[model samples]
Target: MLTIKEIAERANVSRTTVSRVLNNSGYVSGEARERVMKVIEETGYVPSENAKSLRTKKTRVIGAILPKISTETSSRLVKGMDDILAKEGYQILLANSNLKPEKEIEYVRLLKSRHVDGIILSATNINSGLTGEIKRLNMPFVAVGQHIPELASVIFDDYQAARDMASLFIKKGHKRIAFIGVDEKDRAVGHCRKLGYVDAMEEHQLPIEEGWVQKGEFNMESGYHCMKAILEESKTMPTGLLAVTDRLAIGAMQYLKGQGLSVPKDMAVAGMGASELSRFITPSLTTIDFSVEDAGREAARLLLGYINGESYHEKPQVVHHRLLERESI
Candidate 1:
């Protein structure tokens, strides 16, 4: 195993210089810092975890809990969080709750037991007593992709994104639209998206039948069943559909195809999320491009702030989203 001594020797610098550079001490010169870093990389010098722990009195570990990680949204969020945390010598202990609130609470307890410095959470909504949970544990935490009053969060502008997608359908002459939302408590996938649809319908002087809106589990299978049943029971066929997430849109599209119905020509479709799967699907999916990566980075920043006793005082941030128009809509 390579050591700091060997790295310092190879870099032709004192061990103190290498240590200073590794610690990001302000006194090191840029030239010396670059050389030490280069030598450290070239020699594959693995720093001792015990040494790091002793020096910092921290594990440099972050606990991350999410409802489900198989979705593209969560994957992108992890990528973004990694982009920042990796450079700071932090590793994340990731846990999946499989959409169960109890599992999330259990994971929080486990992370606290392990003495992790901070936590990042992604779920439908902030756990109602999440702040109290953290207070009991005496640990710092930040909510991501969801919001709670009086807590730090790295959230996006879900209302605006949902509003934009619905407004686009309305501007394109779609009146009588159906909205299939994801989680009931998901402000982004449910409340915000539905609110956006209603606002657009009212703006266009169209009647939004209460029957036209429903909820889905943000999965292909659930979307297929919901859309199929919705179409079967409808008084009239809708000209536009707004699926709350990309996976739901894909499943809904499959049902439409099975019925020999084509997109836009029959029922125009617009959905949220630009998951990689959307691009290859037949007719392509018209959707919103949200920044999960930005959410991840923001989450890390907030958690790091909390760990350092720094005040990250601000309401949840609403990152930007854009409409990605494709053949589906």
Candidate 2:
């Protein structure tokens, strides 16, 4: 372990000069900085983040709380955030809530306790408990995927994205359309998306059967069951289907295959979230490209703005989405 004093002595510079060069703060002559850098490179000296934080009150670490770490959406978001944060000499500390709302609040306090420079929450649902805790913390924060009131957020146009998909189906002459969604507690995917579908159908004067709508969890198995229920319970069969997630749509397709039905011929299907599986699946899947990575990058930039003393605003930065028309539809 080479101390700053030792490095300064070897470089023929004062310890203060070495400190200034290491911190990239204060002014140091180019010659003196070059000398210090040469000695540090020779000795492989790395500055202590703890010591730097104690002096500057910044850890250079951002805490990211995610709903689920294993999903592709989470990975893409992380990649985007890291792309920006790493360039600015910051690193991410990840906390996975495993889709538990209680864990989200718990991690907020835990991250605050750790004295993170800022927090980025990839929120699934914005509840009062989580929002209240965040407000009390009074730290630099940004929410992604869901908009939080009075806070900076990077959100997707979930409602319009769903509406566009339903319109596409209707344009292709799909009158009897079925919807598979998750719990309405997940307002963005479950509620807004379902509402969009219903509105599009109603606007076109299409009749919706009692069994045309089914609720499921965020998994393929749930989607399979939902599709099965729609088939068994609906008196009039639907010619088109829309699912809130690619996994659910894939599950529904699996059920349709088992029943000896062909896609786009027997039933045209579409899903949200342009996942990799959606591209490779048989006949491919028509889905929404939400550009999740872009959302992550935007969230990081917003948090950094707050951390850097930028003015706070309640307006959310909404990311754009596009529909990928594939063979399924």
Candidate 3:
């Protein structure tokens, strides 16, 4: 119902002065600022964000692209990002990719088109094409969950996390260990974690059976079926199992329950991601706490620094993981 002109007139200040005060750009005397604030408060005036963007060249909004928004991991990360950004007068414009890799790239372009100040991509994987686009966009960007050498990112130590999980079982004297992982397309969660498991197994002189390793999608059903296949095909039963994610681990536990196999006593189990279900499941689960929320907060903080022309170190910021020893192992 009101415009900047009317507010300026009521405050007895030039419209240019009002604009400066509203944008917090040019210097305004304390008296002028107070008068403008009083008039704005009295009139219930709200500045047009579009007009302000045109004047200040800042939308003060960040775009966050995630693969699946409904998951516990994504939800926690978004909350952490929101917590930091909100304090700095910024908000998030979320774009969900529904776990499609191509959609991740598309959302980056779409967010740029919307004139977002920066983008925080919860990257599922990395290739030349995606990296090229990030470079081409030449925008303030940070990748979460996956590490790219060319861009800044906030990532978990997936390899170490997986290795540590395997070591937990090994230290408990598990010789034959089973593994359930997702497609290698997700390099961080699928490939690196598998490599870590393999590394730990080899380090402990444990022989890996051909049928002991199973690959599945990042879901519980996949875990359930994969565990079944392992049970059916493996010549000898595995003493321990390491799944790439908490969902997969939980599914494996369900399968074990159905099969009347006692966890830790019969087959120790562990997973990454530290999902809330890990703590409540029967016998609980040994897992690696990746501190996903911290990753999100750091991603937002780094992206904002880049957008604001501030220096930040640790291009691929590494968030440490903790081993949660539970009844599962």
Candidate 4:
């Protein structure tokens, strides 16, 4: 229950200096800032956010919407965002959609009603309904993991990552390559990644059979089921297989193990995301490192900039990725 007067007294600074340090607005001397921070920490002094919001018209709170919360990709991105926002005295109010597309749009309206300063959306798809709501909200927003036409986004180079994986498979002397991907509604992961894989095959003058391309959900079981379909339906068996996600690739590997096929010998395999389990799995799965955490950090940066009235002419910020070669490929 320490007041600003008591904090200023403890830190040996004027109340104005303490106010500057608390708001992170006017600059105070580095030493004085450190002293004030130390005193606040020691006393466990909590500021009145309600009074601050009434004065400044800023809640200093950001609403973050995620498609799913259980995955490592989501967790890493959240960590990166938290690292940046916490430094600026901002906190996140998370809204998890739990993989339901309808909930994504719903959460946008819900978060907007909460009067948060801004929103960082880990979007799965860019549809008219979602974009329309975002536009109507007229709030600062940054889309992560998916790109919308006019919205600012922080997204990975999904197409290049997928294409690079295909090229690696080709360089390793695997001609008949197969692809397991998600639905086309997801422009980044599903459509762009699949397009890149297809373009790579065509660049190598390798004809792709209809059966070699299988669609699956973003899960291990779907990858297993789609891979099984590829094996059973293809007139000529593929020597290389690339699944869009590590979970899918791992599932495909499981099917191969059940069939008693030797990996990288009888059939080579690779996946996109550098999931934690990818390296530890049998023989280690070759994959691409999309830097999911960096994307989150970038998203937080862009959204905060917008809220602070900084103009970025560029729409979406693109993140880089790397190809990780492992035993599987």
Model 1 agreement with the true structure over 169-223: per-residue lDDT tens digits: 8888888789888665767567877787778778778887655776788688988
lDDT of each: 0.82, 0.94, 0.90, 0.91
lDDT of 2 by residue, 3-48 (tens): 9999999999999999999989999999999999999999999999
How does model 3 score by TM-score?
A: 0.95
TM-score of each: 0.87, 0.98, 0.95, 0.91
Q: List the residue pairs that clash in candidate 1.
A: none
Ranking according to TM-score, highest score first: 2, 3, 4, 1
- Candidate 2 — worst ten consecutive residues by lDDT sum? 311-320
Between candidates 2 and 4, the TM-score winner: 2
What TM-score quantifies how close candidate 1 is to the native fold?
A: 0.87
Q: Distance (Å) between predicted and true CA of 114, model 3?
A: 1.0
- The CA lDDT at 23 in model 2 is 84
- Best lDDT among the predictions, by candidate number: 2
Model 3 whole-model lDDT (C-alpha atoms): 0.90
Candidate 3: list runs displaced more than 4 Å: 25-30, 310-314
* Model 3 C-alpha lDDT per residue in residues 1-329, reported as the tens digit of each score: 89888998999999989988887888999999999999989988888888878876999999999989999999999999998999988989999999887898899899999999999999888878888888899899999988888678888889989988898888888899999999898989989999999999999889999899999888998889999999999999999999999899989989998999988788888888889989998888888889888998999889989998975454688998899998888
How does residue 151 of candidate 3 score in lDDT?
A: 78
Stretches of candidate 1 exceeding 4 Å from the true structure: 1-47
Candidate 4 per-residue lDDT, tens place, 1-329, comes to: 88899999999999999999988879799999999999988888889999799979999999999888888988999999998999888999999988777899999999989999999999888889999999999999998988877878888889989999999999988899999999999999999999999999999999999799999998999988988999999999999999999999999999988999988788899998899999899889999999988998888888889999988535678899999999998
The superposed Cα distance between candidate 1 and the true structure at residue 12, in angstroms, equals 14
Candidates 1 and 3 compared: the better one by lDDT is 3
Model 1's C-alpha root-mean-square deviation from the true structure amounts to 3.5
